[model samples]
Every structure is written in structure tokens, then in C-alpha cells.
Target: MGPYGVETLPPGVVDVPAAPAACRAALVERDRFEWRPADGGDPAALTEEFLLGHGLAVDDLTRPAGHDPAGPCGAALYVSAAAGAAMAGAPSGAANPVATLPEVAVVVYGHARPPRPPRRTEPGRWWVGPWRDSWTPGEHADAVQAVRAAIGRGDVYQVNVVGHAAADYTGDPRPALARLAGLPGARYGGTLHGAGWAIGCASPETLVEVTAGRVVTRPIKGTRPATDAGRRELLASAKERAEHIMIVDLERNDLARLARTGSVRVDELFAVRRWCDLWQAESTVSAQLADGIGLAALLRAVCPGGSVTGAPKRAALELIAAVEPVGRGAGMGALGWVGPGRLDLGLTIRTAAADGDRLHGWAGGGITWDSDPAAEVAEAAAKAAPVRALLAG
Candidate 1:
């Protein structure tokens, strides 16, 4: 029945052209905005205003000190690892702090447009050239040794060492991104495109997810192949297990700041999970938000996930910057949706970015004192192989 006794639908009153596709999420061409840390503006504040402009509630969001609250809403979010480090004032290995990319890239769409179908593409038109590693195997090994030295010096317990690879490609990279989004066991997988660039993320780790009112984060730390032997090896290795626990602890601490007193809990601990051909140790830590916890506060607690940065995030980031040759562009960041009172982001581990004429990717593992340099280097290769193979075709 209709409200106030009106007919739900009066007979034969339909539009001649019918209606829009209700199931599709298309875009308006000019909705994307990129925020660079070097720009001397605030991403969180801009986001709050963007949501407010869309008529969403911003009063519930946490505001910067001495700043007033505004409204905010639906947006596509991409937070680069370098951006996170830059915000924290962590040193970067590269001379440029935030790289050429924006620290935070946002696409503000309230789903007001009609659907746009995929562009016409030839089956074999896509081309990804051979990859060139930014750091040779010896260099990667040296980074691992450096991390071990840091641990020995009592500077850091562990640090994640990542290696970058780049290649030239022709044609659109969206096809490659689409293929990656469909990878097996991808919980929070998708592609986000910005000015002259795009990213494909097939990461299994859940950086953070907020639903209803509860917040949760899954940090993945240790990895081995998805084999019977690999499973046993991963579960049995004291080094792997210890490494995994350290990250789990770090996540707990990160979330505790925002959590209600005595509301934090570890739902799952060091469970082996499969992501394509690899097995990784992941833990689930969840907490109930304290009174009035907002989007900016949540993002501040856990972007550039601890699993990617290693234990004691600040020190690890500094050491990592000094060790790694190139910056971690789109890798080791967060990507996902942010809507009214909701956020679900995944860490960019097995992720690749297409910038200008080049496609870039990075992979690596946590380096503890017990870490073997050669093994760490090989592990990074193993993680990156599948993405490279999928893009090659």
C-alpha cells in the first residue's frame, strides 16, 4: 500500500524510455581528485567537506584539533604507502618524499550516473613488456642483511624489505587489472584509476573493515607456497610464527587507541590461508569504536598496514627507506570503498600500478633477525611471479 492511501502505481503511468540500470556503478568523467602531501592541504578535511557537499553526515566524523566538523560520503580511496610514510614524517629512500603520485586519490561519485559498458578492446591487443628489477638479487639480499643488523643493534625487531620491478606496456591496463581482481581468494580486490595512472590489487590481507559499528583488521605476515609441504613448513616454523605474532600484536595496539575499553579481541590468530599459489599466516583483530570515532581517525590508525611495515612501524619505516632502492609506489598501501559510516580496505601486497607508459609492481617479506637473505629475496620473487605471469599475456 502507498503512503497516505495513494496507489503504489497508478495504472499505465510508466515512462516511455523506461529507467536507468539500477545494478550498475558507472562514473561521471570528472569526479576524481588527487591529494598530494606536498600540496600543503589536508586529505581528511577535504574528504569531510566532499561528503558534506553530498549531504552525508559529517558530524559523526572525528575532526582535527580546533577544526569544525562537516558532512561527507561515498568515495573510492587509494592511500599510497609513501604517502602514509610522508604524513608520518618517515624518511624515504628516494629523494622525493611522496613520489610523483598523489598521497591520496579519491573519486567522488554518489552513483548518480547511468552505466557505462566496457570499452571495445581486442583480445591480443594488450602488451606488457619484460620487467626490470630496481634492485638486483644481491642488493635485495643486502637489504635483508641490513634489517638483521638493525635487529642486532636493537633498532627494530623486524622490517619488511620490498623490491620493485617496472616494465613498459602498450594498450589499456584495465584488462590486466580486471584479471587480477578475479584472482582466487581475493576478499577486497579491485581497480582504481586516476589521472594518467591505475592500480590493480589482488591482496588477500584485509587492512581494515567497518560494518554497522564494529571495526576489524586482518594483518598477514608470513608466507609460503600453497602446498602440503608449504602448509606444514609455514605452520611449524618458529620464525614464521613469531613473525606473524609480532604483527598481530602491533595491530592490536594500533586498534586499541580507537577501541572501547575492554572491547578489543583477536578473533583469529595465525591461521594459514591460500591466495593463489601461496599460503600466508593471517590474524583477525577487531574492536568496538570508542564514542564518536570517525573516518579520519580510523584511517590514521591503520593505513600502510603494520604487516607491510613490520613491528614498531616508525623505526621500521625509517630503516626500510634507507635500505630499499626505489619507493613503493602503489604497493604496500590501502585501496577500497568509503561510504556513509562504512569502510572496507585491503592492503596492496600483490598489487601493480600503471603509470604513463610503464607498469610497476613490488613484493617482499618481513625480515627478522632469523631471516635468511637469499630466502627473503626468493620469497619476494615467489609473491610477484603470479602477477607478472597474468600480466604477460
Candidate 2:
């Protein structure tokens, strides 16, 4: 049993209805904090009342959320490290605790935030509806151009293209997400439903897992449908090889910033792994972060992963900032469970976002000098299929 009032349950276990209410109470009862999500509730306002009611500093509340472009990229909220520390048996904020949040795996939890009905500033609100807008074909083309430029400079070869579509929704996102889960050849697949209207189903090929003192990151660079077995050579072609190497090198450098000098190493190079929906070639990079490296540093070091951003990360980021039409709120963010002395996070990809009435999602492919604009455009559309079909009907 934990002081926070949660007890350990069995694997594939779940907490009862009272769990979330109690967890919310733990923060709301004693602190002035807010847990607003893309959906709507104002945990901040509730936290304020709790702080005033109890004797606590509002700053004591910490936010344990971030953006990842590869897995379920987006902003997330969680019990701060301090909050987790205060609660006996609670995991660190850096480690994702969603799975343990009572009924997360079994019952659909609340949206990332809460549903904001209608207001003067924003009037559209709905329940479980298509809430996303599509990017024009030209804009999509420009994105392809940007990727080509990166490839021309030998920065990267292929980057996955994710298009954005927003929606206002109600009801459990599980059904929508389950549409793609376990799809043949889709590696690192899963859905992360938040407390708001935000939800995403990602078929990530990358893995960032932490065990004991070791941290491992697998940068997946090649992609082709498993059904197209004959295209293996083309899928892992020379151009894709260069792209994988660039990102792998960038990852090595990023880890070096926090990892012990000389401890960083590439465990594997261009190994092909088949998943539910696709076949991918990925390289593994491992490192030992310096003693006392915190979550913030580790994340900051490799955020907006090289696979999406290109090599020379800072430059690619500048490019993204210049060309991307909107801020990638949660697109390309990371999500997963983390615990004391251990953590596991996946890069967010194949995702969607929703507000009150608008639902959005995106898909794109990496472009190099050898890349075909037409192919890239088609790739983007292909990635959008799962979400588009969901929004259509």
C-alpha cells in the first residue's frame, strides 16, 4: 500500500472508480495546482483552492510531462517529482505512471484535460466526433521540400511524415486507438489516452528503455510494409542507410551530453525487425548518463528526436520552426511508464489531437536528395489512413 492511498495490484490490474477521485483528491485537497489537458478541466484552479485550504506552497507541485515526436508526441501532465516523492511508493514524475493510474489499462481514463463545453471565445464542442483539419497538398509538398534539403546536406535520409487533424471528442478513445493497435508490422505500438480530449495511437519503431543504470535508445530509420516483402532491398536502400546513420550518430552525441564519456556505444547497426504493420531497420545506441543526471536534462538532450528533425539537431529544429505551420503541441512527444531507478519511453508517431470541436492528426515521410516528392506525399497520406478513417465515419 502507498501513502498516496494506492495499493499495488496484479499485472494487467486496475484500480476501482474511487482511485482517480482519490488521486485527484490527494492533489486537490492539499495544493493549489492545475491539471489542464487538451480536453478541459482546470487542475490548476483546483490546486489553488487546495493550497489555500491547506498549508502548502503552490510551487511544490511539479509538472512531469513533455513532447516527443516519435511515439505519442504531445504535452502531458503528471504528479511532479516532489508530489511523487511525498507520496510513499509513488514513482518519479519522469517515469510515466499512467498504466498504474488505477483503471488506465482497463477502463478509459479521463481526457488529457476536461471537456470545455462552449464559451464566448471558443464555441465548438462535441463528443467523439471528427475534429481535425487537413493540411493543403501544397503545404504538404513544402514539408517534403524541407526534408529533401536536409537530405541534400547529408543531415538525414528519411524522416516519417505525420499530418495533423484535430477533433472535439467524447467517450473512451480506446475504440478509436484500438483500430491500429497490434496491426501487423507496426513496432512499438500503443495508445496513450490523457485526461483531456487528446489521444494517439502510435506505431513507433524506436525504443528508449532504461533498466537499472543503463539507458538504451533504438533509432529506427527504415520502413516498408511487411506485405511488400520483395521491397526489402528498396526499403533498406542506400539512401535510407545514410539517414539511419545520421540520426544514430546524432543520438550518440545527444546521449554523450548526459552519459558517461566513452560509455556510449552503438549496440546494433541496421538490424531489420518486423512488426505488426511494417518492417523496419534500426540501430541501437546505449549510454550511461553521468551520475545525478535528471529527467529534464536527459529529455532536453534528445528531444524532437533526430529521426524527425534530422542530424545537427539544432539546425533541423530551426528549419522545423521556420516551416512548420503550427506548434507541435503533443505531436512527436514521448510517453510511457517510468519508476524509481527505471524508465521506458517511446517516441510519439502516428498520433492525433483534439480540442472541443476540431480533431487533428498528421503524417509525412523523410526526404533526402534522392527522395521522390510524389512518393513522400503519398507516404504522408498513407500514415494518415488510420486516423482519417476514424474521423470520416
Question: Which 10 consecutive residues of model 2 have the lowest summed lDDT?
Answer: 1-10
Supply the TM-score for candidate 1: 0.87
lDDT of 2 by residue, 1-393 (tens): 011111121112111211222222111111112332322432233333333243222221122233221222111222221121212121111222121221111121222223223222222332455434456777778777877777677664444444555555554343444355445544434443333333444545454565555778888776666566625674548977877787888889878877878999999998877654456677899987576665545544655566765656555555555555654444455545433244566655665544333455655656567777676666666666655565443
Q: With candidate 1 superimposed using the best TM-score fit, by how many Å does residue 333's alpha carbon deviate from the native?
A: 0.5
| lDDT value, residue 310 of candidate 2 | 60
The local lDDT score (0 to 100) that residue 138 gets in candidate 2 is 75
Q: What Cα-based lDDT does every candidate model obtain?
A: 0.73, 0.48
Which digits, one per residue and each the tens of the lDDT, describe model 1 over residues 1-393? 001100121221111000112322343322556776566655656655665565545435332222112322255677888767765557645632223456687665433233455445456567878899988999899889989998999999888998899888887776686578677877766776655666788888888887666889998988899999999999999999999899999999989978889999999998999999999888999998787877666776786689989879999998988988788888898887665665677888898877667788999999999999999989999999998998776
Residue-pair clashes per prediction, in order, are 5, 82
